[model samples]
Target: MNISLAQKARQNRIAALEYLRRTKQGAEAEGEVLNFFAHRAREKAKPVFFSVRARMDDERIAA
Candidate 1:
């Protein structure tokens, strides 16, 4: 589905908040300042991640 610019901006803000949480700086803010920080944080924020899986039994045996 197509998302609007504002919606995308909000999404970016949420991601930035999550990043802030990771770095122990998840204080709430608002308005232009929030958007500005969101944009900046989003730019520097790392991507979402999943943990690596353990090796399967067969693979472990081959090693």
Candidate 2:
């Protein structure tokens, strides 16, 4: 269940490539498709700040 950021990014890249293949756009817009997916992957890979705050609150409640 716990997937690393690098793994997620790789999966996204693979998905993008598969999408291109399925749509027959691999030869024409491969770069654009990859770039878009890479950008989204980076966004998804960002550290979630609110989770840390929520964890702290939960700890306080448990204590």
lDDT of 2 at 40: 88
The residue-by-residue lDDT of candidate 2 on 17-44, one tens digit each, is 8987876675455544446776788778
- Measured with C-alpha atoms, the lDDT of residue 62 in candidate 1 is 88
The lDDT of each candidate is 0.69, 0.79
Runs in model 1 lying further than 4 Å from the true structure: 25-63
**The best candidate in terms of TM-score:** 2
Give me the displacement of residue 62 in model 2, in angstroms: 99
Error (Å) of candidate 2 at residue 5 is 0.3
Clashing pairs in 1: none
Q: What total of clashing residue pairs does each candidate reach?
A: 0, 0
Q: Which lDDT value does model 1 have at 2?
A: 98
Residue 45, candidate 1: C-alpha displacement in angstroms: 34
Backbone clash pairs for candidate 2 read none
